[model samples]
Target: MAARALKLKPPPARLWISEWPRGAINAARLAGARRRLREVPRGDGRPVLVLPGLFNSDRSNFALRGYLNRLGYRAFPWVLGRNLGARTIGVEGERLFARIAAVAAETGAPVTLIGVSLGGIMARLAAHRRPDLVREVITVSSPFAGDPRATNVWRAFEWLTGERIDDPRVAALREEIARPLPVPATAIWSASDGLVNGRACRIGGERAIEVVSSHVGVQLNPDVLVVIAKVLNGQNADHD
Candidate 1:
């Protein structure tokens, strides 16, 4: 049977935590409530372009970018627009591709892409298009096996994104992603991600990792950080 959502019916005592330390049980509600939510392949430290999940803008990724910056890597978010949808698989993709170029031109280094949710798919497509500029792809919750029908939220994706699941444009764009990007890639997902089925996040042709986190909590998850840190450094797996 497929995985089911791990619901948190009882409210947590706390609403927010700046961070979640590693090695702890993947707790959903704390004495205090909080949102909780990682890396490239290990030590390469190339410039990284981060793409936020659906409905998220650069503000959502500022913390992640800051963390990456502190680690001594240059990171950029999509300043061009909020992550609208993959339906723009054609026009918006062109815009996003241009943004990637702009970042590359400014940084003068190959970019390692870190994309979350819908942003994850966009990152993969961008990498596929410009392999030379894209060092590798690191995605969290981006679905590659098309998508799953279990979620009630993806209807929103279909709404905002101009492309329908069967739309010719959407299908055409997916064709490009059929072949995996030439560079190394890692897909991260959680047991509790209700937004997109965790299975959709799988990236073939290399090692993939599964972490324990909610659909919305991955951004604040510390275990996710440890794993993501490994990927950014170019390591496929980590005991850390």
Candidate 2:
């Protein structure tokens, strides 16, 4: 990578080179929703926990959360206020776990986490720490693999957070995802995602659905909502 790239400044117009011919193939699959998407049964018993991206932006997930509710699932938000980078994830786990516990008590069931971007990353940690409470995890546009440099905005994100992009924990996270989760996991990404390298969105040998959505728009995009519904429904059926 160039020193200029490391500075986290704009490259003006760096047309990112696509590495594979899969983008076209992915688009075609998403275009035929009937052919590509299966009829998913409504959930059986678990409630869903929705995590918004870096900015609290829980409101962004309103559409998907509401959809989950309509499908007979109880859905809740992080409720830690806005996602202000106020606390490192390691620090937030206790609170996140508490929220999970509280939600589980309220609904009388285990929970599924649907996370967007950084929230997705948090969901991974939650699932790793508390499998008893988390039945499944589904993320949209979250980069689970090693490096964030693949995404042009990563440097800027680090700068904004005042943290090192290559923090030792970063490497550990990559290694961790290589291990299988106790429960099922699904990742959703898009070729047009201007922020994340869509390829990095894959997690735990699970299905990675390709959706057409802006990096900032996944929470509200109808296509993303549909995929979330399918995964949540599928997970519920597994127990039945």
Give TM per candidate.
0.77, 0.75
Candidate 1: regions farther than 4 A off? 1-45, 86-92, 148-150, 236-240
Q: How many residue pairs clash (N, CA or C atoms closer than 3 angstroms) in each of the candidate models, in the order given?
A: 32, 1
lDDT of candidate 1 over 162-213, digit per residue (tens): 5576677766666566456777888887545655566556645656788866
Each model's lDDT: 0.64, 0.66
Q: What does the lDDT read for residue 109 in candidate 1?
A: 80
After superposition, which runs of candidate 2 have C-alpha atoms over 4 Å from their true positions? 1-41, 85-92, 235-240
